[model samples]
Target: MSDKFTLDKRLAAESVFAAALPLCDVRLMREQRWFWLLLVPRVKGAAEIFDLSAAQRAQSMEEINFAAKGLQRAAPCDKINIGALGNIVRQLHIHIIARIKGDAGWPGPVWGRGARQDLPPAGQAARLTAIQAALAAGVGGDMGPKLSNLLP
Candidate 1:
């Protein structure tokens, strides 16, 4: 995003899961999984979710739901999970993840599993395109900025 979001160094240290889509207001970075997307809103000096104003909070919720819908279409997940477990990147953000049974670290939390399999370049772009197109056609939003392509 052009809105000058300095990546939280600690959060950046973790592997890039995926490139975010367009519905989210700020940078929605991926955390090295096909099932995971992290949405960090572009509010400066905001460390926690409570730092967001009530209006932004509501808008962010919409953004997150949009993400979930896009994910379900793109990945065909068994279930979708949304939350803000921001122990590292304290920015006011949320995560919308697609969960499936018997995939990777199945039936368990996807926090720390072994070295991650960063999606290959072609695959990443394809998935991003799917998500962006689905969100645009499904919800009528534009991804204002190109997602960072730092995979691998």
Candidate 2:
């Protein structure tokens, strides 16, 4: 495994890094209309989850679920949306979004609905702290022994 992992610039500009999981980096999207998180695997040249080995694939799923739980705990919503579309960024990243009934993009996808609004400094700090705490608390446990040996 490569120790040096580079994140795409568009991703970095869109979200804030919240925490480092066993196989991915947990990033919080800047849009305040919805609570969203991105799990970007720390693997080189990975544009999709299939690019990862079987073991890594399992680990990435676990990480994605973990981020979803964390986001749910931080913000309650009617539904949770998870996706991994690399059409623009071309990076292996999973998006976990908390959706509500009357949200800006309700009854539809959040992508390309409108421009994302930036969170204020205080709100950003609060969200970062909450997400960090949820991750540290292990919102969702590891993917068990079968996949244990896969992650370092």
Candidate 3:
């Protein structure tokens, strides 16, 4: 992460703020029902994972898996969907989604399937607490650079 890094605007618009991980910014998508998280590496002008060095890529995967565990603890699901598709937001970022059997997009992809549901303030706060606790419990070594203003 560098002082020059700034999150992509599209990501800022769609995601609910979460913690900053070792190699990425952990975020919760605004859709309420599913546990969808996004991991954006803090590298300016990086549109692909390969843009990062070998060590950075390894660290990013570690952080992604760590976040997956936290997401699982927060909301258990039938499957965990992870991917990095830059068609929309070109910035190098990964999606870590916990999918249940009968979710909104259950048997289909969440993308372009439906509108994003807004979560209640209480629910959002609770989810955030659970995820943060889970990450804290599972993580080892330096937790990485944390942005004071995690929003956007």
Candidate 4:
């Protein structure tokens, strides 16, 4: 495995960078039907959660919870769904989605439900800003220089 971390091409194409956490690179999914975030560990060749060290796994869970809370604050929902299904992506990334009743894919998984509705440029910017702001405010101290700069 290479020491340097590189994001998967498919993930890069489908999401926008939101912030760089200590253990993960936070990204916002392009789908507009629900508020979704991807927490991708910066470890190269880490295809599954087990690939990470014990400390890394703990950090990943913390980051997941952090991102889920930020998502909830940004987009209030009835339920928050989290998953790490890598059947296709093969990347060590956790998905955190805010789900509401009667949404486009209600009572079912969001994957393969229908064609993804990509957010418009303006909507993307607005959602990213909301998420960044929510995360920044939720954290006690500065989220480091990288994350602070990403905040609006």
lDDT of 4 by residue, 1-152 (tens): 56889999999999999988889999999988888999999999999999999999998888888888888989889999999999899988899999999999998999999898998899899999888987877643345344676543
For all predicted structures, in order, the TM-scores are 0.73, 0.88, 0.86, 0.92
Q: Name the best candidate (by TM-score).
A: 4
lDDT of 3 by residue, 69-98 (tens): 778878888888999999978999899999
Sorted on lDDT, best first, the list reads 4, 2, 3, 1
Instruction: Report the C-alpha lDDT of model 1 over 48-116, residue by residue, as the tens digit.
Output: 777878987786776676667767887788887777877856666677677888777777777686766
Which residue segments of model 2 deviate by more than 4 Å?
Answer: 1-3, 142-152
- C-alpha displacement of 143 in model 3, angstroms? 5.4
Candidate 3, RMSD to the unseen true structure = 3.8
* Per-candidate count of clashing residue pairs (backbone under 3 Å): 7, 0, 0, 0
Ranking 2 against 3 by lDDT, winner: 2
Q: Tens digits of per-residue lDDT for model 2 on 1-152? A: 65678999999998997877778887888888887888999998999788999999988877788778878888888999999999989988998999999999999999888887887778877888877766666677743332333322
Which prediction has the highest lDDT against the true structure?
Answer: 4
- Identify the superior model by TM-score, candidate 1 or candidate 3: 3
List runs of model 1 lying over 4 Å from the truth: 1-5, 9-33, 140-152
Note each model's CA RMSD in angstroms: 5.4, 4.4, 3.8, 2.2
- Backbone clashes, candidate 1: 7
